[model samples]
Target: MAKKVVATLKKEGGSAMFTKVVKMTKSGGNGSYAFEERIVSKDSAKDFFSK
Candidate 1:
C-alpha cells in the first residue's frame, strides 16, 4: 500500500493533485503526542496541518 502511494505521487502532475499530510497531536489523557495522517488535496495541505 505504501509503495503504491509513493509510485503514484511520483508521476507528473500527481504531486500537485494530491499530498500526504501528517500532523502531531497531543493526547488529552496521556500528554503524549500522536501522529495523524491523511491523503488530501495539495491545495488543502496547509489547512490539514493548521488544525
Candidate 2:
C-alpha cells in the first residue's frame, strides 16, 4: 500500500523543504505505525507535489 502523507516540514520562508509519510502495520497481533521523511530541496516543492 502507498504510504500516507502525515505532515510537511518547511523552511523559514514558508517553503516546503521536506515531507513526512506514514504507514500502519500489524505486528504480533498488535497495531503499529511507522514514519518516513524525504528531503525536498529549495525550489523543488512543485516536483514533489507533482508525483
Candidate 3:
C-alpha cells in the first residue's frame, strides 16, 4: 500500500494557490521512505505563480 499526502502552496497573504499530492512508499525496515509529488490538475500553481 501507498500513503498519500496533500500540501498547499500559499502566497504572502496566506491564500492557497495550488495543492500537491504526494505518494510515499516505505523502503526498508530502517524507517526509510521514498516520495513522489505531483501537482493537482485543477489546482496547480505553476500557471499562477512565477518562480
Candidate 4:
C-alpha cells in the first residue's frame, strides 16, 4: 500500500494551526486525492508525508 500523510487545519484560540493528524498512509505512491477540512497535527503528519 502507498503511504500518505495528511495535516488538518483548525482555529484554536483565534489562531489557525494544525491541530490533528487525519490519516496515515501505509504505502508510498504518487497519487491524487480530494479531502474535506479537518485539524491535523504537524509532527505526527510528517511521518506519512513530508517535513
Candidate 5:
C-alpha cells in the first residue's frame, strides 16, 4: 500500500534526505501560472528552484 513506501523511508531516515520542491510556471500559450511539485534529494533542492 501507499503507507508502506512512506513507512520505510521514515524508518531509515530517508524522509529527511528528500524534499518537496514546488515551482510555479507560466502555462504554455496562456497567461496563467500553475504549480509543479517534485520530490528531489536535499542536495539538489536549491538547484530545482533556481532553474
Candidate 6:
C-alpha cells in the first residue's frame, strides 16, 4: 500500500503566507509519503495564492 499526504492551506491570519497540513493516508504505510516545502490547495494555485 502506498501512502500519500492530504493537506490544506489557509490565510495566516495577518501574515502574507499560507498555512498547511501534511497528512498520511491509512494505506500510505509510513515511508511511502515524503514531501518537503510542498503546497496543497483545494482551489486553483492562483486562487489559493491570491488570498
lDDT of each: 0.87, 0.46, 0.52, 0.43, 0.92, 0.39
lDDT per residue for candidate 2 within 1-51, as digits (tens), equals 122232222235444554333333446555665443465565665665565
Q: Write the per-residue lDDT of candidate 3 for residues 1-51, one digit (tens) a residue.
A: 122222223335333444666666778878889886765544554543332
State the lDDT of candidate 4 residue by residue for 1-51, as single tens digits: 122232221234322445544553444365655443355655555654452
Tell me which residue pairs clash in candidate 4. Answer: 1-27, 2-27, 2-28, 3-27, 3-28, 4-25, 8-40, 20-39, 20-40, 20-41
Task: Give the local distance difference test score of model 5.
Answer: 0.92
On TM-score, the leading prediction is: 5
Worst 10 residues of 6 by lDDT: 1-10
Local lDDT at 37 for model 5: 99
Tens digits of per-residue lDDT for model 5, 1-51: 989988988976799899899999998887899999999999999999889
Candidate 1 residue-wise lDDT, 1-51, digit = tens: 999977888799887798778898899998999999999998899999787
For model 2, the stretches where C-alpha displacement exceeds 4 angstroms are 1-36
Model 3 C-alpha RMSD vs. true structure (Å) is: 11.3
TM-score, cand. 5: 0.80
Off by over 4 Å in 4: 1-39
- Compared with the true structure, the alpha-carbon lDDT of candidate 6 equals 0.39
Ranking by lDDT: 5, 1, 3, 2, 4, 6
What are the RMSD figures for all models against the true structure?
2.7, 11.4, 11.3, 11.8, 1.4, 13.2
After superposition of all CA atoms, the RMSD between model 6 and the true structure is 13.2
Which residue pairs of candidate 1 clash?
none
